[model samples]
Target: MSVNSFLGVFAKSPIKPMIQHMDEVNRCAEALKQFFKAVYANDWDAAETARASVVEYEQKADELKRKIRLNLPGGLFMPVERTDLLELVSQQDRIANKAKDISGLMTGRQLQIPEPLTEAFDAYLIRCLDATEKAKETIGEFDDLLETGFKGRERDLVNNFIAELDAIEADTDVLQVQLRQDLRKIETELNPVDVMFLYQIIDWVGDLADLSERVGARFELMLARV
Candidate 1:
C-alpha cells in the first residue's frame, strides 16, 4: 500500500493505529522465545541477533504509540471514549517496553539459564508470551466490537478472549512460582550476583503477563461502559 493510503486508514479508524501498535508489541514479546533459546544454548551471536529484533520491534511500537497519541481524534462521535482508548494504548506499550528491557539486560550480561532451570524457564517464557498473543487477539476484536455496537456475538467473543488471557496469565503465575522454587534450590551453586539477576529476570518475564492482563482489564472496562 502507498504511504498516503496507509496513513488514510488511521485517519478513518482510530482503532487501526492501536491494532498496528499492538502488532509490533506482540512481535517484540514473541522475539523473546528465540532470544532465550540462543541464551540457553550459550550462543551469544544468535542471541544478539534476536535481541536486535526485539529492539527493532519495540522502536516501531513506540513510534506508532506517539503518532496515535498525537493524532487521536477527539469528539463525541468517536466509537469509544478517547481517554479509555489512550489508556489501553499506554498499557499495550508497556508490554513492548518490558520485552525490550528483558532482552537488553539478559543479552548485555550474557546470562545463562542454569541447566536444571532451562526447561522450566523456557516454559514460563512461552506461557507469558501466550498471554501477550491473547491480548493482541483481544484488542484486534475492537473494530468488530465497534461495528456491532459492543453487543451480541462480537462482545461475547471479546469476553472469551479476556477470560482466556486471564487463564494464561494465571498459568504464568504458577510457572513463575515453580521456577523461583527451582532456582532457589540451585542458587547456592551459582554466582550470587547471577542468581540475583536471574531472580530479577524472572520477575520481569512475569511482568509481561501481568502487563498483558492489564491490557485485557482495560479493554474489559471499556466493554463494561458500553
Candidate 2:
C-alpha cells in the first residue's frame, strides 16, 4: 500500500473525542488538587466549589464519548502504527472515569486525611496528574508519538513519569499498611469498619494513580513499531 493510503493522525475518527476526553481528565486533576487543598483547610465552601469543577469535567467527558460513539466519522486518521485504537481510547476514558470516581468519593465521604499522610497523598496526586497531563499533551501532538522512524526526548519524560508512578503506588501501599497497624490501639473507638473505609478510600486514590501510569505505558506500546 502507498504511504498516503495509511490512516491520518488528524483524520476524523475517535481520536478527536479521545483528545477531548483527556482534556476533561486534565481538568478533573486540577479540580481534585484544589479539592484536596480545600479539604486540608477544612473549608467546606471551597471544597464544594472544587467539587463542582469535577462534575463539570465529568459531564464534558461523558458528552464527548457519546458524540464519538453516536457520530462516527467517515474520513478518520487513526494510528496506523497501533491497530488497537478502540482499546487505547477506552483505556484513556477509564483514566478520566477514575478521576471522577476519586472526586465523587471526596464529595460523599466525610474523609479525614491524617496530617502526615496528607503530604503523601498530595505528592502522589501531583505525580499522577503530571503523568496524565504529559500523556494528554503528547496525544495532542499525535504524530511525534506514533512515528515509525522518529524518536527523541519524548521517551525521557514518559520513562520518568512511569517510574515515578510505580514508586508512588509502592509508597501508598507501605504507608497504608503501617498506618493501619499503628492504629490498632484506637481500633476500639473507630473499630475495623471505620478503619477499613478509610483505607479503602486511600487505596482507590492509589488506583487513580495506577490508571494514569497505565496511560503512559499505553502510549509507549502504541509508539513502538511492529
Candidate 3:
C-alpha cells in the first residue's frame, strides 16, 4: 500500500486536500483580524460584515473536511500514519471552529469594545493570527515531508517550522495576559454583563492560539513516527 511517490499521486494525496482546508482556516483568521479592527473603530456594521466572512470560511472549511474524510483512501500507505493525519486535520479544524465561535459570540451580543482595551486587544488578536499563520505554514510542509519520505533535510526544515509555531504561541500567551490586564482597567466603566462577556471573548481568543499550538504539537508527534 506504500505510495510510489507523493508527486505521482498529488491529485489523490490527502495532504493536498488538507492544505486546502488549512487555507480556509487561515482565511477565518484573516476575517477575525478585520472583525477586531472594525470593532476597535467602533464600526459595528463593518465588524458584523467581517464576522460574516469568518462564518462563511468556517463553514466552507467544515465542508471541505467532510469531503476529504469521505474520500480518504482506506489502507493507503503514506509518509505519516493515516490516523495521525486525520487527527491533525481535526486539530486544525478546531482552530477555524474557535474563530467562528469567537466571531459568533461577539457579533451576536454586539459587544462593544472598550476604548482602553483596544490597543491590547488588537495586539492580542494579531498574535493569535500569527500562531495560526505559522500553523498553516507548518502544514504546508507536508508535501515536502512526503516527497523526502520524512527524512534528511526535509525533516529538519519541518522541525524548525514547528519550533517557530511554538514561539508564536508563547508570544500569544503573553498578549493574552496583557489583554486581560487591559480589560481589568475598564471593567468598572462597562456594564457587568458586558465585562463578563468581553472577558469570555478574550478567553476564546486565547483558545484559538492554544488550538494552533496543539496543531503544531500534533505535527511534531506525527514527525516523530517518521
Candidate 4:
C-alpha cells in the first residue's frame, strides 16, 4: 500500500482515533458485564470466555493507541493540539485498563464474590458501565461538535452529556462506598486472603467509573480549547 493508503486504513481526523478508543472502552464494558454474570453464576467456562474477550479488547485498544500516536501528523494544520489529543487518548485508554484489571483479578486468583456482597457488587459494576457508556456517547458527539465548530447546540448538547456523565460517576462513587461497607461487614467471616482479593477487585471496578469520568472531563477540556 502507498503511504496514504496505509494511513487511510486507520485514519480519520485525530479526534476519530479518540472516538475509536472510546469504542474499545465501551466494548470492554460489555465484556465486563458478561464476565460478572458468569462469575456470579459460578460458570467458570463462560467467565473464562468473557475474560478473554475483555483482554482481547484491551489489547486492541492498546494497538489502536500506538497506531494513533505513530500516525498523528505533527503540523499546525491539525484540528486540535496534538498534545491534547494524546492526553485524551491516554485518559480514555485507562477505562479499558481498569476493565481488564478487574477481569484479570477475577480470573487470576479465582476470586469468588462474597455471598452478602453479591447484590451490591452487581449493582456497582452496572453503574460503572453506565458511567462508561455515558462517556462513550459524549465522545460520539465529536463529529457533530466539529461540524458546529464547538458552538451553539452542539456545545450545549455535549456539555449536557458531560454533566450527566458526572452525575452517573457520582452515583457510582456512592455505590462503591456502600459496597465497601458491605464487604467489611462480612470481612470477618471470609478467608483473609479471599477478602483481600475481593477488596482489590471492588476497588478496580470503581476505578473504571473514575476513569470514565476523567475521559468526559478531558473531552470538556478539548471543547474549551477548540
lDDT of 3 by residue, 1-226 (tens): 1234433444567688778788888898778988988877878899889999999999988887776676667677776677887888899899999999888888888887788777778888888888899889888888878888888998898889889888888888888888888788778888999999998998899888899889999999988886
Off by over 4 Å in 4: 1-6, 9-12, 76-79
Using all chains and alpha carbons, the TM-scores for the candidates as numbered come to: 0.96, 0.72, 0.92, 0.94
Alpha-carbon deviation at 98 in model 1, angstroms: 0.5
Ranking by TM-score: 1, 4, 3, 2
Q: 1-226 in candidate 4: lDDT tens per residue?
A: 3446547754556566668778987897769988988898888889999999999999988887887788877783645788988888889888888888888888887788977778888989899899899999999998788888878999899999999989998998899889989889889899999989888888888888888899899888877877
Q: What is the C-alpha lDDT of each candidate?
A: 0.92, 0.62, 0.83, 0.85
Model 1 — TM-score against the truth?
0.96
Q: Which pairs clash inside model 4?
A: none
The digit string of per-residue lDDT tens for model 2 on 107-218 reads 6775656665567657666755665676577555454444423346655555565566566556655665665555554555664665676666666666666676676667
Task: Indicate the worst ten consecutive residues by lDDT in candidate 2.
Answer: 1-10
Candidate whose TM-score is highest: 1
How well is each residue in 50-84 modelled by candidate 1, as lDDT tens digits? 99999999998988888878777777385579999
- Cα lDDT for residue 65, candidate 4: 84
lDDT, candidate 1, residue 17? 82
